[model samples]
Target: MTEHTESYYAASANEYAPFPALTESIHCDVCVVGGGFTGLSSALHLAEQGYDVVVLESARVGFGASGRNGGQLVNSYSRDIDVIESSYGADAAKMLGSMMFEGGEIIRERISRYRIDCDYREGGLFVALNHRQMSTLEEQKANWERYGNSQLTLLDEEAIGREVASERYVGALLDRSGGHIHPLNLAIGEAQAIKLNGGRIFEQSPVVKIEHGSPAIVKTAHGQVTARYVLIAGNAYLGDKLEPKLAKRSMPCGTQIVATAPLPADVAKKLIPANYCVEDCNYLLDYYRLTADNRLLYGGGVVYGARDPDDVERLIVPKMLKTFPQLEGVKVDYRWTGNFLLTMSRMPQFGRLENNIYYMQGYSGHGVTCTHLAGRLIAEALRGDAERFDAFARLPHYPFPGGRNLRIPFTAMGAAYYSLRDRLGV
Candidate 1:
């Protein structure tokens, strides 16, 4: 059985009963694959709407990026609003802007309605590394404001230091609507809610083949799900061969994170005075936040080929200490890595296969909140309301250049150029 990685979130996640693997064939109104945020959220929404839902996961729930991410609920898509407007025109941008914050809202509503204890916090900060980046943030603040985000504040150098005891950042953008959470607990809680709503979930049931028809048959190792509809929510960790076409549109990249031993209350409070999650405005950015237990959870470091590094701590600690020099000898409690799907355009790809098979993937690294929005949209589409979902689907997506053999090297080259621009403050 595939298990969740040994990380801080896994160690601290809420306890839940193990879902039995699929051992018999079943039929339902909806057959959802992938047990992470998108699949679970889709199941929860469909179950609430009186649909017979069955979820199949290759591993345990939250075994993928949903559980191992930085835990920040950063709003907005991977490609900024400006890119959306420029690429797809103003009409598409206006539509997307309206729904940018809905994902985070869905998360908040679920936590409250289900009483899920995921250590929910209420703020996030985008720190600027230099004057050029601050200028970009000023524009970002304006763009978000035009989109009905009223909880934004741009902090100057003095305010930036006050918000995060870091001298590396010259300024910061604070978004009250963005926050952090114990992501794995959120997933597990939603899974429990799915069961309560009469939906069935089967873990360790990796899909072998999906036979598309009037009622699709999703064959797993031990069983099959015959359903009228199928929603493919698997992102990076989707190792199955059900969709070679969709897999070609995205490449998985690895990111690592480390958690320090719980710090003294006073020291923790001093590090981030307001307890806001923080991420820099760099091409290769660093994000960190204080856990509910006062430990510093820091994450950054990219592996282009989706290859896990040998020493996660060695790769991450120096980055953390660079942002905060006082932590010279802090013991790293836990470290792990996970992969997220990336698209060439850096925008999410949402579309349908045949008539009833739907798929959502390629949120890049900005999926924590986007996945929640996707679940709602998918549910809406299933209920004959595909207007909003279609808007996202209509956006153009291209396969990575040079195909799978050379896509990694090609992407790394593009990233290197941007990283240089970030370092040069261009």
Candidate 2:
């Protein structure tokens, strides 16, 4: 019964054919659970490699965070490479740094190879609200440079204003390699590409149980899939009925987004002349970009336990107006919320269960590109190349301190502390 939210992305999504639900037992080389970016990307790669792949979704493809996200194809992990270097060591950081941009590259390569049009734009800006954030961006630029990212430029206050037309930023960093897109369309296009490659996708097929063996059996309400390998990429929206162990290591966090009514083309150009997607540097950040049809898609705010509010637009519109006071009376054309998995360390979780089954989740708020990277690494491991996959698997993950019940308030307190620091520009 899961369905796509009534958001701008859903309304404007490219033609996506409805996939039939699983009604009979079937067999495949790999059965992937969750049909968002991770599962779809993994299935596409596996299908291209000639594996008999089948994807199962609790709802339509891209019905979760993948479709509802802010659509920025940003590079790197959630915690950043410097944090990785400090925690893991120079060697681990170097290895991770090497793969930072590959995820974005994978996205571009797919769009070109498959000729999928998702209104792919080619610029992104990380803005600073104060000197502390600017310093952080300087360090980030230097850190990314060491990792072979040369498409970066630091912008001063004046340059930042010129790039964004907003006076809210003190400085900014532009990454030429970073970009934005219609995320839902990208997922739908990839699903279509997978179908064209002969992979099967069943929508509205919630996995009720998983019976594991040398070959695992994935059961839906009316059908089942027996596969040599089972890859679970169901991140935040994944329920715990199937696997409680995977659910504990990460917590689901909800985020809200609002889209303004289409403005005049000239007014849109005046608002963000460069048309680059921008995100501010803060614990709870605001991200926005101009859509293809001239609407401003703005997103921010978070609920730690993934408890969605009834009035998403009311919660997010004020933040948007705070950033752009000129749009104080702008009509909100669409509003929605989505959940993403968050880990204590702000890093993704990649590991295997029962040898033949694998799972990857915990991208935090940086799923757009990292999911693609995870998909690639998972596929490599399935093909007998486990070196890269093991690298991510080595990163440690911990359960929430207060367990399931109290983790929400505990994490909210921690987030509030950082948010206070951000507000004070500490």
Candidate 3:
């Protein structure tokens, strides 16, 4: 069986026995083509509602970005609802706005209902490095409040220090609903929940092709699954081979993270007194949080092309130190990189391939909360409640300009431009 990537998450994950690989053709009501958050969530939801579900995973569960991410439960899409309103319309924005906070609610619900011991903690902070970012946070506070989020509290520099213990931020925005978790453990817990609900999961069964029809046939090396519906949830790892059309509009980008050895209790408290997760407000932001074991887990920086960096430490250490210079001599216990699917629009891609083949991918960088939301929407649609799902399908997804060849350089150029603006505090 394939193993999870070497990261702090994998090292500290719960002991889960590997699910067996598919060995023969089988039939089900639905076939999920990935085992990360989206696949497991869709399968679990379908299984809960009495649908026979089969999940085929290319590697171990949570082995992809879902496992290696910074584990922040950030709300809203990469492009927030206000942007959707201006770009789409008021109606489209309202439909999306109603669901902006639902993903975090669903996460908390799963944790409580299933007794998932993923070390979930409530609260998240968006810190601002300059006056411009502080103004943005103020705007965000108003926007989020308009969307019915009353849990938000704007923190001035003094208040920010009470939460962040940092002198670098001008201010911060705290979202009580947002939180962090041990993501790999959450995936494993959800996988077990799927089994408890009678859903079949097959790891090490990478899909080879899909024969779309009334009943789609999903083929793997040793087995095949015939099902009424299919979902392509592989995101960045799906590659250009499995779905060439998807490869055109979306590109994979790598993000790196590093974890320090467990810090002393006093040091941990001084770093993040309230134990809330934090991410700076920037075009390309830096995010960090204290782990359950008192380790300071930090991540930032994006590699436009999906290639892993030669050294994850070299990419992330400087950023971590910038946030907490006191940790100059701290030992980094782990370092790893993972890919998040990026689209030209910086929004998720959701649409239909054929009559029965549906897909939900390209979450950009907001997969943590949005993936769970996608799973619920997919379930609702399959159960004949598609009004909610159609809201997302209505958005137009454009391919990156210059196609695959020039997309990376093009995106990198844009990122450089934004990075410069961030530096200038414009």
Clash-forming residue pairs, model 3: none
Model 2: lowest-lDDT 10 consecutive positions = 160-169
Residue pairs in clash, model 1:
none
> What Cα-based lDDT does every candidate model obtain?
0.93, 0.93, 0.92
Off by over 4 Å in 3: none
Off by over 4 Å in 2: none
lDDT of 3 by residue, 1-426 (tens): 678888999999999789999999999999999999988888888999999999999999998999999999999999987788899999998999999999889889999999999999999999999999998889888888899999999999999988886788989999999999999999999999999999999999999999989899999999999999999999998989998988899999999999999999999999999999999989999999999999999999899988888999988898888778999999999999989999888888888999789999999999999999999999999999989888988788898889899999999999999999988889
lDDT computed for candidate 3: 0.92
Candidate 2, residue 263: CA error in Å?
0.7
Tens digits of per-residue lDDT for model 2 on 71-110? 9999999989989999999888888889999999999999
Across 1-426, the per-residue lDDT of candidate 1 in tens digits comes to 788899999999899989999999899999999999989989999999999999999999989999999999999999889989999999999999999999999999999999999999999999999999999899999999999999999999999989898799899899999999999999999999999999999999999999999899999888999999999988998752779888888999999999999999999999999899999999988999999999999999689878999999999999999999998999999999999999989999999987999999989999999999998999999999998899999988898899988999999998999999987889
Q: How far is candidate 2 from the true structure (C-alpha RMSD, Å)?
A: 0.8
For candidate 1, the TM-score is 0.99
